[model samples]
Target: MNCTPIVRQHPDGQSINYYGVTLFDEQSSKSLKGIFTSWRNLFESAPNTFEITGNFVDWDNEQDGEYERININRDEVVNQLGKIISMSEHLAKGNCYLYHLGK
Candidate 1:
C-alpha cells in the first residue's frame, strides 16, 4: 500500500506537515468501524475519507472515543485500543490531528 501524506491545514490556510504516515489494513478498518460509527459521523467531509480534521479532534476528553466491545476478546483489541487512546491523548494536547490511509 502507498503511504498517505498526513498534513494539517490550519484555519489561516497554512498547512502543517507531518513526517510519518499512518496506515490501516482491512482487518484494522473493520475493527475501527465498530468504534467510528456511520459515514455521516466519521466521514463528514467528502473526498477526504481518511482524514480527521480539527472539528472532530477539538474536544478535551480523551475518552470520548471509548466504546464497549463486550463480545470481542479483550486480548485481541487491547493493543489497538491502547494505541488509539495514546493518539487521542496526543490530539488532546492540540495542534495535531488523527489521520490514516488504507486500500
Candidate 2:
C-alpha cells in the first residue's frame, strides 16, 4: 500500500489549525478508533516526548496544580499510528469489542 499524508496544518501567524486527511482502507472497518489513532499521532502530542530531540515542552500541556499527565512524544506515537492506519488484515478480522471503562 502507498503511504499518504494523513494530516495537514494551516498556519495563521501564531496559531495553526490541524486537520486530518485520511483514505479509508477497503478491507478495514471505519471505526472511531481507527480515525482517532491518526488524529492523536499527528497533533495531540508534543514533538519531543522523551526529551530525546527537538523541543520537548512546546506543545505539552502541564497541569496548573490539577492532575499530572506525562508528556508524550509525537514521533513514537506517529509510528504506532502508521501501524494502525496500515493495520494487518488479520487484526481487522479479530472479533474485538470497544468499550468505555469509565464515565
Candidate 3:
C-alpha cells in the first residue's frame, strides 16, 4: 500500500489536498476508516497546529505475508493532521466532505 497526498480542484472552484491511503483489500480499508473516525475531532478541528501521541500504522512501508503494518510516530500524525486541516479550510462553505482518494 502507498500513501500519497493529492491536491484536487473541483468544478465548483473548491480545491483540496487529500491525504490518500491506498488499501489493497477490504480489511485495510476498514482499518483506515476506523482510525479516521477515532481521531475525528482532531481532524475536524482544523487547528493551525497540534500534536498527537500514539502508535499508528505507517502506510508508507511494505508489509510481509497476509498483513502489513508500519508504526507511525507522533510527529507524522501531527504533520498529516495539519495538512488535512489546512486543505479542509479551502473547501466551499457547507461542503463537509473530507477529501480522500482510495483505490
Candidate 4:
C-alpha cells in the first residue's frame, strides 16, 4: 500500500482548497475508510472546513486505486478533536502538500 498526500485547488474557484490522499491499493483504501468513518462526527461538526470524498481512479495505464479528497482549512484542523487532530498533525508535518505518507 502507498499513500501520497496532495493539495488541489477547486476548479473555477468555487470552493476551498482540498487535501487529498491517493491510495495505491484496496487495503489502503479500506484502512483509510475506517479511519475516516471513525472521525466522521468530527468532520461533520465543521461542514465548511472539513469534507471527505472517495472515488476510484486510474493509477497508471493498467491499474486503478482509491482517491480520497478531504477539503480542509489548515487553521481549523488544529481545533478538531480526537484522532482527527493527530491525523491532521501528521499530514501537516508533511507540509500540507505533495508528500508520501505511506509505502
Top-scoring candidate (lDDT): 4
In model 3, the runs with Cα more than 4 Å from the true position are 1-66, 93-100
Deviation of model 1 at 26, angstroms: 26
**Model 2 stretches astray by more than 4 angstroms:** 1-28, 32-34, 44-46, 50-65, 88-103
Q: Compare candidates 2 and 4 on TM-score and give the better one.
A: 2
lDDT over C-alpha atoms for residue 1 of model 1:
26
**Candidate ordering by TM-score (highest first):** 2, 3, 1, 4
Model 3, CA-based lDDT: 0.41
Cα lDDT tens digits, model 3, 1-103, are 2222223443322222234332123223333344444565554554554544544445656452233344445555666755544444433232343435632
lDDT (Cα, 0-100) at 91 in candidate 2 = 39
The predictions' CA RMSDs to the true structure, in order, are 17.7, 12.0, 12.9, 15.2
Top candidate by TM-score: 2
- Selected candidate, larger TM-score, 3 vs 4: 3
TM-score of candidate 1 on Cα atoms, chains taken together: 0.28
